[model samples]
Target: MTTSTTGGRTTVADTQNPPGATGGRGRSARKRRAILDAAREVFLRGGYLGTNMDEIAALSEVSKQTVYKHFGSKEALFVEIVTSMTSGAGDTVHDQLPQPARGDDLAQYLREYAYRQLTVVLTPDLMRLRRLVIGEVPRFPELARVLHEGGPARAMRSMAALFERLADEGRLTVDDPRTAASHFNWLVMAEPVNRAMLLGDEAIPSPQELRRHAADGVRVFLAAYGPGAGHAPR
Candidate 1:
């Protein structure tokens, strides 16, 4: 579960200065890319409050003046990193779990979906991002809202929509699809994810372990919502 697949860097290259511009537009683009990449590493290591523009500039091999020219301020760069990371997670999860109209074999579908979600959330990079956001929340509370909307909220909506379709087809007895979706997603994630967040990535469940967790969650979900269970919201 590496964060290699999502949007790691966004280069605000100059369109006015073409790739072959004599004003060093090409150099500007390279420097911008370097600064962003360096910022990511530095921020991840030192966090938002601890990171400094000078450190980023030194790591990026650009002058501090150049770093300021590209990003303006440390807060602006940190904001981009967080927004891109969370937004990337949301977009990636939706792609993996497309809200289907309906499907058969309840346990299998849920197990697969759970595994996918687990995999994405348990990534080391995402886990670190979670820690960063939580640490930043006390001072920058709006960041928490951004994180929820970009990650968990988006994933839950996708799951809830799927549940609604399942209910419509009489495959599940869902009264509140959104709640059911949360229950299912959390069922598969709570223990392992909590362990990872609290105890570090080494505590994160292995692939086989995640499969078992997903399977167990699917079983519980089916017991409660499967067609003939009469399992109602309590």
Candidate 2:
């Protein structure tokens, strides 16, 4: 764990996992998280081209060689950062959704889910991350793929499952739940995220704005596909 940034070594204690456990597995996981967190900050500030392993190591307080040992290369580290961020962001929200599709509570569940999504995007660090990915995407197509897998695609997959369950219960009449999920997400995020990305961090919408979006999305979804939608198989 002794590496060369900021006049210190990134000891095992610096990791997220608590100190001392069975074997050294817990310590390694902690070290990985520390490295990932440091890499995220570095990537956000420097972009892909500006990022360097030595600098990341220094920022992480792990040695230069230690950075190499953990991530192998700058590109790998960037991918890891994107993967982690995307996982927590888009996918995690869907995972929190009710598995069986509580039709009665659908509105409330969607509202909460929308709020979590908005919170993730509006956070200062995550906002910078989205910008950074967009900026580097043209030059690095892999970044786009990673973002897709971690973000929209992941969310859609989860949403499709939920929608399929709803359809089975005759709460929704979705023929292609995946497409419907994608469309719903677009309706929810298009305006606010577009503005935030364009205006940098300064354009993040207020909580009231997010609440409105959530309400509208839920209303539209229910109107289009909910129980009374005639499309539901009689």
Candidate 3:
């Protein structure tokens, strides 16, 4: 599969089979996965401008023509790398977020949710990819947009849905789930993510530290949106 971004929208192409295709579909898929894996490593080690198709092909153990046959250009491969990684991370966080249940400890649920999101997103590769995309914003602005939409925006939407459910259960006094979700998201993410991004991977918080941050963020969120908090719509 290959991806293209247009006007901040990403569309994937099914390039597993093309006209007069020679190899079997299984072989093509393996090559595609190999290329993506190799490209991801290369791009993360070296930013977009520094990466080359020849290096990627060599690492993947495929011919240069095979690399081009799978992903038309270096830019396309890079875009695919960004989209795949971000989307995969988003999916992991979304899928693992705990569902709010009646009589459930909302604070614990939210903390687990927040901590899961933080751990998934604060990985070395994802952080490096974020930095690389930011540096290339002027050249590949759409890539940055795609990264945000796929990672943060998607997470916010999932969070909004959870908040809406809590409100319906009278567990939260949310007036606007989206707004409440935004607050909860940045409350949990901003400090840790910024620290890691600016200060390097070594600056990433330990599990105990991240758990404390998640707990603190949940406390603040509940103060504003918890039952009887009287959080009015802005």
Each model's Cα RMSD: 7.8, 8.5, 7.1
Better of 2 and 3 by lDDT: 3
Whole-model Cα lDDT of every candidate shown, in order: 0.83, 0.77, 0.90
Model 2 scores worst on lDDT over the 10 consecutive residues at: 9-18
Listed in order, each prediction's TM-score against the native is: 0.82, 0.81, 0.88
Report how far off residue 91 is in candidate 1 (Å): 1.7
TM-score, ranked from best to worst: 3, 1, 2
TM-score of 1: 0.82
Error of 1 at 98 (Å): 4.1
Instruction: Evaluate model 3: give its lDDT.
Output: 0.90
Error at 8, model 1, angstroms: 34
Best by lDDT: 3
Tens digits of per-residue lDDT, candidate 1, 102-171, equal 5456677678888888888899988998899899898778878988888778878988988888887888
Write down the worst ten-residue block by lDDT for model 1. 1-10
Q: lDDT tens digits, residues 1-234, model 3?
A: 799899999876756557545457778999999999999999999898889989999999999999999889888899999999998999888875657779888888889989999999899999999999999999999999999998889888998998898788788898988899999999999999999999999999999999999999999999999889966643
